[model samples]
Target: MNGSLRTILAASIAAMAMTGVARAADVPIVPYVEPVPVGGWYLRGYIGMSNQQLGKLDNVLFTPGTVEFLDSGGFDAAPIYGIGVGYEFNEWFRADLTGEYRGKASFTALDRYDFNGDNIWDGSNDYSANKYEWLLMANAYVDLGTWWGITPYVGGGIGASRNTISNFQDINTPNGGVAYAPSASKWNFAWALHAGAGWEVTQNVTVDLGYRYVDLGDGETGDIVGYNGLNTVNNPMIFDSLTSHDVHLGVRYAFQ
Candidate 1:
């Protein structure tokens, strides 16, 4: 080949290489993006303080002309703890299964002097007991729209409870006082009404502060001895109602 022909081929090759480089430089680079989480199922834990009420204490002796009457009854506040699993079915509705433990509460009562039938109502038969409950519930809630990442909610639940009454005693106040009604466990229907707000800490985490009005039906004691030794062992006292107003703080973690 001649020098003219060789030079012309070299020039064409050089132009093609430079054109390829220019095309590469014209392409744009894309920045990488990280993934974000969303909600589905969740797990929760909670703790609370309970202001409990023990309704009237009923004695079998209060029936007919039995000579026993309830003068007064009261209860002390207690604590509670729970755990649950739930599903979020969109941004407005959710459901959960929860198990809870209510700490023991103390009770007190007085049986007045109806035994004398004088209608003066004078003597003191003192009563005391400790109660606790194991509760299981299925609940549903309506989550109002999120505003500033805070969601207000209302809900309800129906369930069962194992209520226990322990360390119960009835002091005669006359026979130098005595103990009656041993420990006993009973199962009952339970229900709750709830209102609360949830604060979104992140896409997958939340904090809840709430209030609940719960009803635990009733509880009772074991056999009663009446005194140190008596046929009163045939009787057991009943706590007519067990109810509470509760304030709780909780945390929820959602699975994305």
Candidate 2:
């Protein structure tokens, strides 16, 4: 090719390359965006404290007017630990299955009896025991919208509770009496209502702080027997309307 023709072609190629560079610099660059997941499975663990209550005590041996309570039965506060597996369907909904162990709580009460319908108390007995529970639940929750990486939620659960009564004693205040009942466990219907807030700690981790009101049905002891093998009763003592209010802290790890 001629030198003049070659030089003209080279200039044209360099001008096209410079124009391409200028256009590239003028075009805007898009910022990187993080994607949100639609749904996921998660594992959770929790620890909590429970304030327990017992409505009353019942015994078949005690007639309506013949028995009176000097002190109503009640339970002390207890600690709780739990683990669960869950599915988060969206930013606003989730469900889980949980199992928990409630630590033992001390129980106390005092009562008097009138064998004859005289309305006068013949004698009194002081009751003492310890109780614990194992609870399993299926729960669903509706999460309110997130604000500053924290989401509040409300939920409910239905399940079963294994309530246990142990170390039950009836101390006769009139005499130095020692009557006792064996440890017993009963399975009962259980339910709970939950309210909480979850704070996002990482991309796949959330920390939860919550409160729960739970109904654990009833708990009971085995048949009553005297410590000296005398004056045994045929009926068990029942703890009616067992319930609790709980405060919990937990963490959930989502599988992405």
Candidate 2 on 1-256: residue-level lDDT in tens?
A: 9999999999999999999999999999999988877679999999999999889999888788888898898788899999999999998999999999999999999998899888777889999999999999999999999999999999999999999999999999797778899999999999999999999999899999999999999999998888886654588899999999999999999999
Cα-lDDT of candidate 2? 0.94
Per-model TM-score on C-alpha atoms? 0.81, 0.88
Candidate 1 Cα deviation (angstroms), residue 221: 0.4
The C-alpha stretches of model 2 lying farther than 4 A from their native spots are 1-27, 32-34, 231-233
lDDT of 1 by residue, 85-153 (tens): 999987888999999999999888876555666576545688888999999999999998889999999
Best by lDDT: 2
- List lDDT for all candidates, in order: 0.86, 0.94
lDDT of 1: 0.86
Lowest summed lDDT window (length 10), candidate 2:
226-235
